[model samples]
Target: MTPPAVVEIDHRDPALQAAFCDYVPRVFRTVDFRRWCEWGEWNDDYRAFAVLDEGRVVANASVMRMRLRIEGREVIGYQLGAVGCVPSHRGRGLSRGVMSAALESCGEAPVLLFANKNVLGFYPRFGFKPWEQALFGAAFHAVPGGEPAPVLDLVEAHVREGLVSLSEEGLAVTERFGSRGHARIASWYAANAFSRPLRQLHADAWVFAGVENGTLYIDDIFAREPFDPRPHIPRLIDQPITAVHFGFTPERWWPWAGVAGEDSEAYLFVRNLGPPSGPHRFPVMART
Candidate 1:
């Protein structure tokens, strides 16, 4: 007769963390929080509010503390993710309970999330407004003498270590809009997102890129120093024939002003943070 109580998942407790992990893939088929946790990148920044049904997570919502750069200013915000209620738990307002608890924990901090087409109308009930995202792109031509960038296997310890180092020491890839402390989320994508590879440009520079249908999508770059990645773009793909697009703001990496167009796939919703006046794309790797 009584509803299950929502509780905060304690990442410090392995059992609770495992329970949370088991519940996640049931909702998000592509995400693997367990693998990310095994890599030891899961930290206190990510907090989950959940409803437990006999030691198993049945409904959940989470908030990730983010160090974000918006309009050239550094500010702390929150990201909402891992939100769902199991099929058996649906229609009982369990999701609403957990979401309210998660937002309450965030107080007045800005929160953002990427929702799928199915849930397009669910978030607005919580005061989240849909924000438009732009894709920045330019023409591409492979350099005549370019060699393919070496792809690193993320399964290798050293390769993962290299990304960890760059994530900690590298300069901000963009000042327009992106995440700062995003190493953990980046690692999550590295592990679970199939086919996307980590390519080495310089000894200290690595990029999460993929080639599809003659187009190269540079999702995000990790570099230990300030450097132009344009020259190395040709090396990223051996047979590029179409355009190159950046998943984040490209002002710091490219010389030319790229053309901007609406990103239909970017279903971004925000609370407490006004959208930037100009075009911008949040780093693909930073989304939780």
Candidate 2:
């Protein structure tokens, strides 16, 4: 049996750097490869590994950092992301090699990720456990007929007229919650939006500013203790919204169901990236 040649990659090493530069289009195409190449060059929290065959790159994966504050404690975790094996190496077990190496290194902080149900089934044998609610679909609220009301129009108008676009607005919103609310959203565009400016790198994300899908999905947003996502759902007493799919707490969400006929619920399969039985409080940012 030929042993797989798998080892951690130093992003700066010329050989491994060339491998990453080559695979961006095949593995992930949403963001330009240059950004990841830059990420490799700039970020210290990222780690990578490549599977080599007789001194040539065949597969690679990366471990990136995600910082979350849960229950008043600052939890800095490693997220297993940007994993892809070469087409020729698909059935060669190179994935397990890279995953095993990444899992072996996580010490104190728990590691996590979100994969489709089929992929989730593959991680458990490696000592990962499926943590419920570790994956959550949007807690949705159907607007009255799925159309933005006058108030929503005003909000869009603010951005369209390009009047309330400034970092000052974003700063004011940051105090409410980290970065997951409407206030923070408005602030995000005001500050990082390309057309506007506060932070440089995020300016490209501003296209989401004027985009009102007429649907609001609150996923890992303002997560409170016992994972109670019910009351946090904005109550629409007199308003006419079609439905609201509350998060994991479907029981508490019953009142919300009254707003619509039948709310759809979607959950993701979550598997831990640590020991056989470890802390399962892995945040939703695994998929973020």
- Candidate number of the best TM-score: 1
What lDDT does model 2 reach? 0.40
Give each prediction's root-mean-square deviation over alpha carbons: 2.0, 10.0
Residue 115 deviation, candidate 2, in Å? 1.6
lDDT of each: 0.83, 0.40
Return the lDDT, model 2, position 131.
Answer: 43
TM-score of each: 0.93, 0.51
lDDT of 2 by residue, 182-225 (tens): 22223322232221122111221121211133433322222122
The residue-by-residue lDDT of candidate 1 on 102-199, one tens digit each, is 99999998999998789889999999999888889888766424778899977677777788788867866788888775867887886776437889
Candidate 1 at residue 236, lDDT? 81
Q: Give the deviation of candidate 2 from the true structure as CA RMSD.
A: 10.0
Show the colliding residue pairs in model 1.
none
